[model samples]
Target chain A: MTALTPPATVTADGVIVIDHLTKRFGPVLAVDDLSFTVRPGRVTGFLGPNGAGKTTTLRILLGLVRATAGTATIGGSTYAHFTQPMRTVGAALEAASFHPGRTALDHLRVYAPQAGVSDARCREVLDFVGLGPVANRRAGGFSLGMRQRLALATTLLGDPQVLLLDEPANGLDPEGIAWLRGLLRHLAAEGRTVLVSSHVLSEVEQTVDDVVIIARGALVHSSSLAALAALAEPSVRIASPDAAGLTRLIELAGWADRLEPAASTRPGVAVLHRVTAAEIGARAFAAGLELHELTPRDVGLEDTFLRLVGEGAIPGVAEPRLEGVVR
Target chain B: MTAALRTEYRKLVTTRLWWILLASMAAYMAFLAGIMAFALTQDPGSMTGGAPGVEAAPMTPESVARTIYTLATSLGYVFPVIVGALAMTSEFRHQTITPTLLAEPRRTVFLAAKMLSSVVVGLLFGIVGTVSTVGAGAGVLALMGEPTYLSDPIVVRSAWLSVVALTVWTVVGVGFGTLLTNQVAVIVVVLAFTQFVEPILRIAGGQFDWSEGMSKYLPGAAGEAITGSSFYADSGMAAGLLTSWQGFAVLLGYAVLFAVVGRVTTLRRDIT
Candidate 1:
């Protein structure tokens, strides 16, 4: 029942800092000694599989669930200790409902005053999430996607500088997904920290600036998305009239590792080793090989994610019992 | 804390269920009053039991006050209890507690706001319902050639004190609701214990003088003490029940105990 000590620093720029947080549900270690920092002004995608403990970690950070053995702080204070929590950190942990009989406007109206937000802010947030027209409608009849939008609007009511959303895109349509992505980027642009957890890595592939992937209740990789992309092996596709000559040139260049030929649809084409396309083109030019086309096949985020989780690139830990569920 | 209380009050006022319950309370009380007025007007001699010159004891202030007290004390206990239970249970059932806690992370503020709103609405509805019962009953009684007036001190005091008791009852129900955290459980337990078990125990206790002392401590007896009518005393059980202040103190003690326990449980437990 004792409260944890506050962290050393509380700043708007330091959105969240976790120091070896651990949470256990009975015998199950839901989240292990997981530590990561989410910087301000970027969408940090908390990437993990279904049982990878992403939600558990977020719940611990929000103080919704007590950590069994470590501390997490936001703005240098535990979430429960924040005097004005709404203005400091806005979180939507799960899809929770308001009374179905209450109108959308009434729902926010009741909660807004407690957060010290003006009534006008409720309408503004509704409009911000494109829920203005249905503001007066009863929330019980709203579609799941509409509820998702309202939930987001609820989080935005206090105009918090940090946002934590768990699987926000779960029920969104394509247009809604695009809107959310743009909205997240817009929030980040305004120097607000946004941490969004999603099982679908492809959805956040373009939306997030950085990612912290976890598997089996432990960190697997923590780096910028661009850095992960750079670390991925590249593929080079080359189309040439003299395919054999180009293959011989690639072999001579000692880039024969993991080389495979192109499909028949592109006749006289040789897909060279899993090296950067620029390097393959540079070698072809040096060998005086005639090349009709050279295209670099960018690695998909799914591949990088699988590689990280599968390879257990995380710094430390014993094998977890739930490792099979991570993939 | 004030802002949170305002929000809670606003929510309770705007909720359609609260309005529906209020209307139902009024209708039930009015219906009962109408029945009494009709019976008294139609058969004027029945009330006086054929006493010579009794001639339909003309709906005196005491009679009207008695009716108002009976309705208020009885229905007052039931309606406020239901309303208070719903106030908290609805949030839990609808999963609105998560957002509410998020908005006001200090659990104490949320519970206090809810308690304040319940007290205000309970008292307001109690007064409105009591006054309507007396007014409607008096009107019908007068139209039926029987006279009743609000000027009687006892009638006025009964109406006012009923409001206080109803408010206290609402908070008690809310405390039970918080402790149980289940709407059905609170309703069932409150209804069964207050209506059936307490009266039976009071009766059984009367047969045995040793148990008579315990009977006065029952909720029904304590509640009757506030309304200035002892059903057990009339039934030949106890000589005297608790005084008004003593009864109020007992009810308040029960409410505060439950409320504190509920508040502590809500603060310590996970929102999920």
Candidate 2:
């Protein structure tokens, strides 16, 4: 399960496959020729900007919405084929999917029998999500954060093997977010397949092992988080009192084109792109240049995400890797 | 299937709408039946609004009992229809269908469960309607020193048939609600047709021979025919209507038609 395959190739138990999926709502295309695979025993972040078809893709996978073109399947079968769907795959598409008039316990009770769970299990899940105190309160009176917890509790009624949660942290506070991160990590640690969707990369950065980012209903980049990090340009930052000598050494080595001038407020400091700190250190020593500090700097994932979603410009990133998998 | 049915029932009972509608039906049936019984027994001549030369004919005891008992279907049928329609439409209106369909992905089986639950709710409303209408109407008849006829064979049959008629009406509401899938729109159409449109059409059906032949098949008319008695049918207006069994078949056919059409058309489309 730890083996990380190239983008769009990995498949195993609890894997989700979306192939050539196209959904057109009248003249406007919601999802266009999108394809990706989500593997089990890890948390995969489905990242995209708002209105980028993330919900539409998830809805298609769960059989709530019909696809216009291709297929979305779980474990090589459509969702509707499962005799016990809630047990096989637990999905919470939105927190607002609840009827406001029902109490939290009653809401779970409604689905518990269908999920083949006991009434006791309903109470257990309510407690698990920290909603036990208000289990009998009408959902309409609960706060948005409490409603989100209730939605999550409903998904856990079956203790499903696969979990799909979209924007699960939308209404949560900072503490609630931290709690969710811990909960997601715990769920994934149990070898369950977890795919969570969000528009903000940083919001899921600490939780996701892999990411499948899309924009305008198309796959932008799909790879392990480490692989995506490797796409950033390596650079080195050096500060020295003998800045003139450092400049001359860089000029003589024909590396001046990659050098960015030091900040005016902080003289005698420069950053060199496309080079490691070790290389800069060895060259500076050879030229007898005294360096006060030398550190490697890698661009953060937030930058990469913004660039992928067409939200910002990030120069020097390689053309995103693409693979066509028909299956 | 059993699980789906249980879940559907739980979904219905968890809300206050069903009982609220049931109570309203009971109250409305009692009031309508009591007033009708009083008018019929106290001054039979006033039934025609005292129109000149239009003397109200003296009604038999059996006919009076049948008319009073059948009010459960003739007047209170709309309650079960509303109850049944809301059973399905609330899922859409509240967006609860997302979680519901997620839990049970087989759309057909989900709909089957909804239909079954509608039958149960319909039966419940039928019982409430019957007890209130019969209890109040019979009390009025006794107060007027008239024969209640509560145990008369035809009168008894009318009471039971009224229950069956209300049950069928509930199923009809479910079918149309599924086809429409919009709570507000379904309720509007149901209220308009049952309260205004059908009454006018049924009355107009009596004015023209061509329309009268076709009007007997309308949903409300079929309901009245199934009960085998109604204040309207007591007059010459329902002279050429279909037989009682035929009315049952016609009303049941409408239920099936609405469900099958809804199943193939709107219900099969994407929920989102």
Candidate 3:
């Protein structure tokens, strides 16, 4: 209520607690007893497969959907408890969550009052999102990228302490993605808790401070980005003309328990985890196995995400990629 | 609540639907009233049965008010109802309800604000239709040297009641919108019931002794009571409808019934 600070009823540090949250739609369990906490002053990535209940959870947290059991709270209070919720939280669930006939400014105008924000602030947020040029453009005519910016502008209109964005980079070009990355980082630096959900691993890798990855309506992994990065162990990848001989020699040498199976590569390539390339090269020479390809592999966040959700986790659905359209 | 009201008001004005429906209703009522006045002036005893309501009523100043009230209710009620329906339906249709509920997650506050703002729109439509119909009716009366005493008690009472009836129609429409989120289905059902189904039922009810009592409780019949206007002795319809106050209470009940059910469902159900 005072100046720019959030109300006293709001959790002091903006900690979002999803405690034993469960949701059911007839026979389908959309969210299955999920629990996680999003800390303040950090960007938390809400990652999941397509039907992993990411959107449902977000909707529940925002009070757009009724939870069958458990609770999702912001700062120890439910979203509906806040007299002016926008003052405490700003969520951009989707870019298309606006009337098509309304212009960008008019769309913001509709919610600005509800958020206890001034008209000037709406314009400021629009300019902040680089959408000032087309402020008067109707949303129906806006491309997905522009609409995304408009949605972001709406989130900032309240000057909220917490933000929940779903797939913020979904329709953005590389530059727009980069811009959003910087924007999220800047907002986190300003002491706001930002939870952005995305199915794309690489897109959220560098931007997020922590990751809470879910698959098939269950949490696979939840850890800080730094911890996950540190856990991504480098491996030794080798392909040789006498690949069977090399595999035999490596297995005989007893590097790690077992090598990760190679795919579609001739000469039977092998990737050895927790092994040095120099040691493999030395051992392969000693065994007289002529190597065609011997390379060191630096593990990335994407690899960690893929391994957690895993291949064939959901039947008839493609596994998340470590190196995809993301640059 | 104030912020929510402002948001709903802003939403109503930003779209073209509100203004377009308002104008159409006003224009349609004005033309209908003018044509009825001209036809009646041509032959004062032209009470020869054609249109059911105009059959036995004599051309008089009091009848002018009745004509305006009846035409506004019978011919122009659709506009306000549609405006109300679209006001609620558009939020769900365009997915704007996500943002709306997100901003202020309390369902009752949001629903209440929307419902109240729709009443304002209903009032506007009713006012416009009343004025247009009265203007045309009075002008025709003057041209034919008939009485133009629009200040007669019946005209005065009927004018305001017409506005009230229109407002109730809209409030009930909001209820229907909430009950059925699918805009196309709601529109088709409402149009079918009002234009074809309900009228046919009323006509058949008028012919039978047992079913005639059931017609009094129909929404249209309730609307007539609220407007405080009833056809004369031989308008090809029964005059044994609910009293004016009784009709007001009935429409009020319908509004509360539809709106409460819709609001409760919206509150409990997920927005997906």
Using Cα atoms, each model's DockQ against the true complex is: 0.44, 0.73, 0.82
Interface RMSD (Å) of candidate 2? 0.8
Candidate 2 stretches with Cα past 4 Å from truth are A1-11, A234-298, A311-327, B50-58, B236-240
Residue-by-residue lDDT tens digits, candidate 2, B1-272: 99999999899889888899999998999999899889888766456554444345566777878888898887678888888888888888889989999989888898889888888888888889998999999999999898998878888888988888999899888888888888989989989988888876776686677888798898888888988886655644443457789889999888889888988997788878
List, residue by residue over B1-272, the lDDT tens digit for candidate 3: 99999998889988778898888888898898788777766764554456554335354656644664466876677888888888888888998989999887888888888888888888888889888877887788778887766767767787778888888888888878887878898889888988788767776676678988888788877877776675422244443567778988998788778879998775568888
Using TM-score as the measure, which candidate wins? Answer: 3
List the candidates ranked by DockQ, beginning with the highest: 3, 2, 1
- Report lDDT (Cα) of residue A236, candidate 2: 80
C-alpha lDDT values of all predictions: 0.76, 0.85, 0.81
Please give the range of 10 consecutive residues that has the lowest summed lDDT in model 1 chain B: B51-60
- Please give the ranking of all candidate structures by TM-score, highest first, separated by commas: 3, 2, 1
**Candidates' TM-scores?**
0.81, 0.88, 0.91
**C-alpha lDDT (0 to 100) for residue B235 of candidate 3:** 40
At residue A125, give the lDDT of candidate 2. 87
For model 3 the local lDDT of residue A305 reads 79
| Candidate 3 off by > 4 Å | A1-11, A241-248, A255-257, A288-292, A311-327, B43-61, B231-234
lDDT of 1 by residue, B1-272 (tens): 88888888877876788778788888887886677566655653344454343233344435544554456565446777788878888878888877777777778778878887888988877787777777777777777766564676776676677777778878777777778777677779877877687766876775566887777776666766676654245324343467888878888777778879988786567664
Q: Give the C-alpha lDDT of model 1.
A: 0.76
Worst 10 residues of 3 chain B by lDDT: B230-239
